[model samples]
Target chain A: DAGVTQSPTHLIKTRGQQVTLRCSPKSGHDTVSWYQQALGQGPQFIFQYYEEEERQRGNFPDRFSGHQFPNYSSELNVNALLLGDSALYLCASSQTGHYGEQYFGPGTRLTVT
Target chain B: DQQVKQNSPSLSVQEGRISILNCDYTNSMFDYFLWYKKYPAEGPTFLISISSIKDKNEDGRFTVFLNKSAKHLSLHIVPSQPGDSAVYFCAASEGGAYNTDKLIFGTGTRLQVFP
Candidate 1:
């Protein structure tokens, strides 16, 4: 079983440009969460989606938005990106209402120039 | 302020030795604690977790201990091997076995098991 899958292993974008990252949840899972990991730092929670609606969000700004489709897939979008936005974007999937470990994807490296 | 903290930036231990990684948190609301191992260029992998009601949880050679009063948690690896070398992160969640809670992660400690 494919645990979790993310698209665009790496990406390069200019400042002020928008970028989108995609993620497919693990089989039998419906919740998707996005995280950003900066250099020398741990993964920071961005937001979590369930039932195609955002259930919770972290301290990130509005520029960091996301969408959950009916297929249990997710998309993370960053608008007007800044150089500081460069980081590794990770996607994690878990079953709703279950106390289990989250399955993480390989992550997408975003470099904002 | 960092809600979760792994003070040790790196540690080196000989093979077949015990590797203990420690973590501390400032949030008392956190009830679920987890440890994750991460390799370079990959996402953090869930290692083990302990609920607030439990003081310790063990799986194979890995064990996690939690101290509710001190807000401290630790991961112990017995007879550490070379393959165990990786960055270890401590994460916490507020609602334990109740609802969906976002995970807060620490800076992480890099463990290197040498031969």
Candidate 2:
């Protein structure tokens, strides 16, 4: 089966602007989680959504938010983007409340100038 | 604080040899652990996993060993292949379901296998 997929494989934005990244969970998956991976650094969790509602969030600021639609697709919105926000934004999908595994998407590379 | 840790930033091994990647977690409550392998420009793919109750779990050329007392886990790749070269990530979760379990990940270790 096709795995998780994210749109706008790469994007360029300016500081003080807003950007939205999109993702579609893998087939048979319900929960979607967002992660930001800086260069040469491990991924840090942003937030998780299940049943169209956010369930868990990380230590990120309010400027980072997400939404899960009824189709199990999701969107990540960052307002007032900063140059530091430029990184690989990965989207992962797993079965809602699953104990098994999580599948990640190819990720959207956001570059802020 | 970073709950999961992979001290080795990179490792190199000759093909057909064994490769061991180490990971230590500070959270004692974590009961499940997993390893993901990622190639450049791609997302991480699940390699193997082991529950806290078990000491070892093997899948073909991959094996994961977990030590509850030490709060450590290691993945052993036997007879490594050139295609196995990638960044490996260690992750852990606890109390799955009930909105209690969230997978915490560590900084990845890059592995290079020379043919």
Candidate 3:
């Protein structure tokens, strides 16, 4: 049984440019959420997607958006990235309506230069 | 404001000794608390959880204690091993509240188990 999987283990982006990170939830899971973990900081919730629609979002700005495909996979899009955007982007998955006990992915390390 | 707080930034324990990491929250609305263990450059793995209805929950070598009145919780690891050295984060969720799966996390405490 494969756990949650994320793409592009590591990435480097320039300021003012946009980047996309992908995630495939753990098997038998239907919900996916994104989080940002800055250096020496805990993971902060970004947003959650359920039933192919964004269910809830955190305090993040609109520049941080996400999409959930029918396959229970999700993508996090950060537009016009800034140096502050450099962090580890984590993806977690859980069963619908049962949001707790989310299994996390390895996460993508995004370096915004 | 940090709803969930892990006051200790780091903790060191001798291998085979007990490790008690503490966490406190300001929000009474939090109904569920969880403990996660994370290694370097990797995502946090769920360790143990306790619901507001219960005061304690134990899984294998991990045990979570919740004190509703004090709005505090703690994770106890018995016979700590060197592999247990990592950052431990405390998370709480108001499951039935406004947000969907909004888990407020503490800054985390780095646990070093010395052998």
Candidate 4:
């Protein structure tokens, strides 16, 4: 069985540009969530998608958004990127009614130049 | 504000020693807590977790203790091995029934176990 997978292992974007990172959740899981891990810090929650609709969000600003397809894959989009946006973007998946522990992907490293 | 904090940035211990990593949270609403370990260039891997209702949870060689009144949690790794050397993180969530349990994580503590 395949675990959660993410695309574009590493990426570089210029300031003011836009970037989209992709994620495929673990098999048999339905919920997808995104997180940002800055240098020397733990990951901060971005948002979560369930049933193709956003269900929960963190303290991030509007520049961050996400989408979940019917197949349970997800995409995280960041617009008007800033240097501070440079970080490791992680994707996590879990079953809706489980104990709430999530399985995570290796993550996409986004470096805003 | 950082709701979760791991004050220790790094720790080193001889092999076979007990390693204790601590975490504190400011949010009382957080009921479910988890510990994760990460190697360079990898995502955080879930280690063990505890719910607010429970004070302790254990797995083979790994245990997590929760102090709800003090808003503190700790991960204990007994007889630590060199392979266990990695960055450890503490995460918390509200654990709602229907909503996704979004985690709030700590800065992380790097552990190095030497033989």
Candidate 5:
């Protein structure tokens, strides 16, 4: 079974531009969460979505937003990106009620110039 | 403030030896702890986890030990193999607290198993 999958393996954007990244949850999973990992640093939580509604969020700013579709797929959008936004964006999927042990997808590398 | 910390940035161990990676957390609210293995350019893969109620959990050659009193957790890999070399990260969740599934992660420790 394909675990979790993400689109646009790599992207390049200039400062002030916007970008969108996508993710498909694992089979039989209903929750999706996004994370940002800077070079040489561990992933920092972005937000989590369940039932097409945001359930939790991290310390990210308003420019970072996300959407969850009925199928449990997800999208992470960043507006007015800054050079500091360049990082690896990761998507993780988990079944609700499972104590939050998530399975992750190969992240998308975002390069903000 | 960093909630979780993996003080060792890197470690080198001989193959077939036991590799112990350590982690400590400052948050008492975390009730569940997990260990993940990550390769360069790839997302982390869940390895093992232990709840606050349990002190240890073992799977194959991987064993995770949690010391609640010390607010510390560790992953032990016996008979370490070359394939086991990777960056290992420690993650924690608050369980039902705040009714969210947010996880806080540590900076990670790189393990290199030499054959």
Candidate 6:
């Protein structure tokens, strides 16, 4: 079975630009969550999507948004990117009932120039 | 504010020894805790976890201990091997029925196992 997958292994974006990263959850999983890992730090929660609707969010600002398709794939969009936005964006998937464990993808590295 | 904290930024242990990585959280509502291991250029992989109901959970050579009163948790790896060297992160989430609860993570601790 295929695990969680993310597109565009690495990306470079200029300030004031916009970027969209994609994610495909693991097979048999329905929930998708996004996280941002800055240099030398652990990942911080961005938001989670279930049933094509956003269910939970973290302390991030409005510049960050996400979407989940019917097939359980997800997209994370960041607008007006800043240098601080440069980080590794990770995607995780898990079943709705099983809240404790989440399988993570290799993540997309976003470097804001 | 960082709800979860891993004070030790790095640790070095000799092979075949026990390695203990510690984590502390300030949120009392956090009942679920997890540990993840990550290599360079890779997403973190779940290592082990413990719920508030259990003080300890073990899986093979990996074990996790939870101290609810102190708001602390730890991951123990026995007979550490060189391959076990990686960055370890501690994450916690509040009680919730769905999988939407956001996880608070620590800064991370790097473990270097020497042969």
Using DockQ, give the best candidate's number.
Answer: 1
Candidate 3 wrong stretches, greater than 4 Å: B96-100
Error of 1 at B55 (Å): 0.6
Ten consecutive residues with minimal summed lDDT in candidate 3 chain B? B94-103
TM-score of each: 0.98, 0.96, 0.96, 0.97, 0.97, 0.97
Residues B22-45 of candidate 5 have per-residue lDDT tens digits of 999999999988899999878899
Candidate DockQ scores, in order: 0.69, 0.55, 0.51, 0.63, 0.54, 0.67
Docking class of 3: medium
Angstrom error of the Cα, residue B93, model 2: value is 1.4
The worst-scoring run of ten residues by lDDT in candidate 4 chain B lies at B92-101
TM-score of 5: 0.97
Q: Show where candidate 1 strays beyond 4 Å.
A: none
Q: What is the TM-score of chain A alone in each candidate?
A: 0.99, 0.97, 0.97, 0.98, 0.97, 0.98
* TM-score of model number 3, chain B: 0.95
Docking class of 6: medium
Best by TM-score: 1
Q: Which ten residues in a row have the lowest lDDT in candidate 5 chain A?
A: A94-103
After superposing candidate 2 on the true structure, give the runs of residues whose Cα lies further than 4 Å from its correct spot.
B97-100
> How does each model score on lDDT?
0.94, 0.91, 0.91, 0.93, 0.93, 0.92
Cα lDDT of model 6 by residue, B1-115, tens digit: 8899999999999999999999999988898888999999888998887888999999988999999889999999998999999999999988543445777889999999999
In the range B39-108, model 1's lDDT, one tens digit per residue, is 9978889899999999999999999999999999999999899999999999999878643578999999
Candidate 3 residue lDDT tens string, A41-112: 888999999999999899999999999999989999999999999999999888865545988999999998
Worst 10 residues of 1 chain B by lDDT: B94-103
TM-score of 2: 0.96
Each prediction's interface RMSD?
1.7, 2.8, 3.1, 2.3, 3.1, 2.0
User: Clashing residue pairs, candidate 3?
Assistant: none
